[model samples]
Target: MTGFVIRQLGPADAAAYREIRLEGLERHPEAFGSTYEAEAALSPEEFVRRVVEVPTFAAERDGRLLGLVGLARESGVKRRHRGTLIRMYVRPEARGSGAADALVEAVLDHARSEGLDAVLLAVITEAEPARRLYERHGFKVYGVEPGALRIGDRAYDDELRIRFL
Candidate 1:
């Protein structure tokens, strides 16, 4: 936790990123929009493409990845000023080690560098810890998206939040 490094993930980090990504999806299915099965089926090249296409930041300590977060900029003419934070996850053992906070900060810093006026993200309504994390980083809830994600027979609502840079 003391010497963790936060940096942008590149092609060489695809494998580590994929591993932690799948772990997050599998362990907390309700916390993510993508399913484990879907991501698990993706080819190695696809994971490489993902890290290249999306601006992803990873937290690493002693050569091991601890967490990651991605910032996807909007492409539309009107929405180009905004970016969405996605695929945020920190390894279970890395929680409370400042990895999550560092990841979120990296995303925001990248958003600013890209000239984004705002950054948006949606957290599961029941995930109070995640919600609090966002709030502590200057994000404020603007609305609640009812039943944003559905896993099997259960439905999960999402809290929509935004931070203006």
Candidate 2:
């Protein structure tokens, strides 16, 4: 595979973004709060609005989107200094290609550019590779939320991690 570049996603990328996002939610139900069925029911305009509103970034290779991640800033008066990293996923075929790493760095870079004091994210306790990636990026586990996600009969815990800028 050729090299991939990470860049901010926009409204124009709504369709592609929706495709990969749905794939992630379907393939890894415990990894996200939103369900594939719920997102699949959303209108195209909704996807467009999401890309327009959220600070999303994608890994694109040869005109095809391989992975994506998003950052959401805290809105409260006292919490405005921080942002949360959300919806991080990479295509299975793109694993080990540095797509995940690049996507993460892009979000941190965006956070820094926005003058945020810190960035936070939650990874499922069982997702070791993902946890290692965040730890390598200087994120430390602050806490763990038990039964953070319930899908079917299974409960998944999430490790809350944060990186100070």
Candidate 3:
């Protein structure tokens, strides 16, 4: 953790972001809704657009992008007080290195700075480590969404978690 640095990612980081993200989608299909086939076809320009449009953060160690997280605020006036945490992933080699914690902390810090009232996230129910990680950061389980994501013939449940800031 001491050697890893978390920072905001921009268009310049499109390549690294794409690599890490594709890895997540491919290596753990059930953990994410997006499929590798869909993401792999996207052009570099699309990745650049994502970096420019989304508020993304990354944990880097020795020039390697190990973890990533994205935060998005609701657009509707009624839901503007809430933010969504999305696409959190840490390279397998970096797991248990506190990279996920650092990325989550960065998101929470940003949420506070933006005056968000709460932060929400949905994780696969089978992802025990991720569920525990969120719990350690004050995120509480609100509900379980059945059949939240389906890959081929398999359906995965998602647990909705929220933290009131």
User: For each candidate, what TM-score against the reference?
Assistant: 0.98, 0.98, 0.97
lDDT of 3 by residue, 57-141 (tens): 9999999999999998999999989999998999988999999999999999999999999999999999999999999999999
Candidate 2: lDDT of 59?
96
Name the TM-score of candidate 1. Answer: 0.98
Model 2 poorest ten-residue lDDT run: 1-10
TM-score of 3: 0.97
Candidate 1, lDDT over the whole model: 0.94
lDDT for each residue of candidate 2 in 55-133, tens digit (9 for 90 to 100) = 9999999888999999999999999999999999999989989999999999999999999989999999999999999
- Alpha-carbon shift of residue 83 in model 1 (angstroms): 0.3
Q: Sort all candidates by lDDT, best to worst.
A: 2, 1, 3
lDDT of 1 by residue, 1-165 (tens): 568999999999899999999999999999999999999999999999999999999999988999999999999999999999999998888899999999999999999999999999999989988998999999999999998999888999999999999
Scored against the true structure, residue 45 in model 1 reaches a CA lDDT of 96
Note the Cα lDDT for every prediction shown: 0.94, 0.95, 0.94
Worst 10 residues of 3 by lDDT: 1-10
Structure candidate 3, residue pairs in collision: none
